[model samples]
Target: MEEVAVVTLEPWHPWPLVFPAIVLATGAVMTFTGHLRERRWVRDIGMVLVVGGGLAGLALLGLLSGSWDQAQRAEALVGLGYEQPTFSGGDGIVGGAPGVIDFHAQRDGELVVGRLVPLGDAQWQVVEGFRDSQPKDSGT
Candidate 1:
C-alpha cells in the first residue's frame, strides 16, 4: 500500500472590481427615477444616493487598484524565493512551522503586502496573507 498527500492552492479573488459597477448602477437608477418626479424629498434622496454611490465606487476602485498592485508584488516575491532554500529559522516562520515570505509594495503612498508560503514541497505558493496588512502586522 502507498500513501500520498495532496495540497491545494487557490488564486486570489479580485472582488473589488465588481463592487464599483454595482454601486454606480444602483445609484444611477435611483437618480433617474427620482428626476421623473417633482417631490423635493424624492429628489433629495436621489441626489444623496447618487453621491454616496459615487463615493463608494471610487473607494472600491482604489481598493481594486491596490489589490492588483499587491498581486504583482506577490508574484515577484514568489519568483525571488522560488529557488532559495527553505530556512528553518528566519523571517519566514511562525510557531515553529515554515513561515510565510511577505512581499510589500507601495501604492499611492500606502503599503500593500502579500504572503507566500511553502505548499508542501512543490513550490512556494501565495497564501492569503491579509486584505490590508501582513499577518505579523495584524498582531496574530
Candidate 2:
C-alpha cells in the first residue's frame, strides 16, 4: 500500500511554504515559522533557517504528514535538481519533535522549517547544509 502528496511543495522556484502545509498536518511548524518571519525582532527564530535540504524537508514532511516516505523523498530530490543525495541518519532529541537549525539548501533558498521551538534568547547557530553535513576537517 502507498500514498502520495497531491502537490510537491516545490521550492524556489518560490511560492510561500505555507501553502501545502495547510493540506497536511499540524504543530509549530506552521504556527511558529510564519510568526517568526512576521516578527523579525525574534532573532533566534527571526533569522529563520531552512533546516537540511530537499531530502531533509521530505523527511520532516514524511514524519509529520505520515502519508509520505521514500518514494516522495526520491521525487523531491529530482524536483530540487539535486543528484544522488546521500541521506545520513538524523534523529531528534525528543521523539516526534523535529530539530530546527540554520540550513537553507533544502528549500532552494526559501524558508521552510524542519525544526521549530522556543529558541529563548540563545544565540542562533547558522550552519548551512553543506557545512553541517561535511565531516569536520581533520585539521580543525
Candidate 3:
C-alpha cells in the first residue's frame, strides 16, 4: 500500500454566466419580433445588442475562467492545512505566476507568512522558509 495526499478543488459558480445568456435570448427575441413587424430600426438595435452582448459575454468568460483556475489552486493549498490560503498575484484579472499561493501558519507559537507552489498529483511544496509577519523593530 502507498500513502499519498489528495486535495480536492472547489467548484466554480455558474450563476454569473446566466445574465449573459439572458441578454442573448432577449436580443434574439427582439430581432425576431422586429423583423416580423418590418421595423428596420428595431432590428438594427437588436443586432447591436446581440453583437455587444456576445463580445462582452466572451470577455467575461475569459476573466472568470482565470479566476476559477486560481480559486481552485487556492483551495488545494487550503486542503493542505494552510490557514487563509489565498490566490496572490496582480489584480484579480491579471497577475504574476499561475500558482502563487500566500498563506498563514503558526510556527514556534507565532503567526508567520508562507508561500506554496503546486507540484501536481495533489501535492504542493512550501517555498523556502516562513517569514515573521511582525516588523523587525517590534520586540515580542
Candidate 4:
C-alpha cells in the first residue's frame, strides 16, 4: 500500500472529544467520592465541574459540527468551477437564514453572486446569480 501525506489541521477537523469525556468522568468520580465522604463543598464543586464540562462538550460539538458544515458548503461552492470563492457575512458559521449563505466568486473574469442552500446530505443548490453579465461596479 502507498502512504499518503495528511494535513493535521483543517476547518472541518473535529475537536478532541476525549478531553471533555475525561473531565465529565473525573467530575462524576469526584461527586461520588464527595457524597460518600459526606463533604458538601466537595460535592458541590464536583457538581459544578460536571456541569461545566458538559456545557463545554456541548459547545465543542456544536462548533465542530458548524465548522464541518461550512467547510462542506465551501467545497461545494468551489466545485461549481468558480475561483477564489468568498462567502459574504461570516465564515465557519452559517449566517442569515438556516441552510443559506451568500457567496461570490469569479469565472472567466465575471463575478458571480449567489446563495448556497443545502439540499440535505452533502448536496447543495446554487440559487440566484451566475449570469453572463459584466463585473459588478465597485461603487468607487
- Candidate numbers, best lDDT first, in rank order: 4, 3, 1, 2
lDDT by residue (61-136, candidate 4, tens digit) is 9887776765765666566566777776522334543555667787677877766555444444676463323456
TM-score of each: 0.39, 0.26, 0.52, 0.60
- Per-residue accuracy of model 3 over 1-140 as CA lDDT, tens digit each: 12224444544566787787777778888898899999988888888878877887898888997788667766664555555554343223124323535555544455546555555444556653545344458556
Residue pairs with backbone atoms closer than 3 Å in model 3 (clashes): 90-95
Pairs with backbone N, CA or C atoms under 3 Å apart (clashes), candidate 1 = 92-99, 93-99
Q: Which whole-number lDDT from 0 to 100 does residue 46 have in model 3?
A: 83
Candidate 4 error regions (>4 Å): 1-18, 39-45, 89-98, 128-140
Per-residue lDDT, model 4, residue 22, is 83
Q: Can you write out model 2's per-residue Cα lDDT over 1-140, one digit (the tens) per residue? A: 11112223222222333544432323335436557577444433322333323334566555544333333444554454434433344443455443432222344445322211213232222222233444556885
Candidate 2 weakest ten by summed lDDT: 1-10
Which residue runs of candidate 3 sit more than 4 Å off their true CA positions? 1-4, 78-140
Choose 1 or 3, whichever is better by lDDT: 3
The per-prediction CA RMSD against the true structure, in angstroms, equals 14.7, 20.3, 6.7, 9.1
lDDT of each: 0.51, 0.36, 0.61, 0.65
Which candidate order results from sorting by TM-score in descending order? Answer: 4, 3, 1, 2
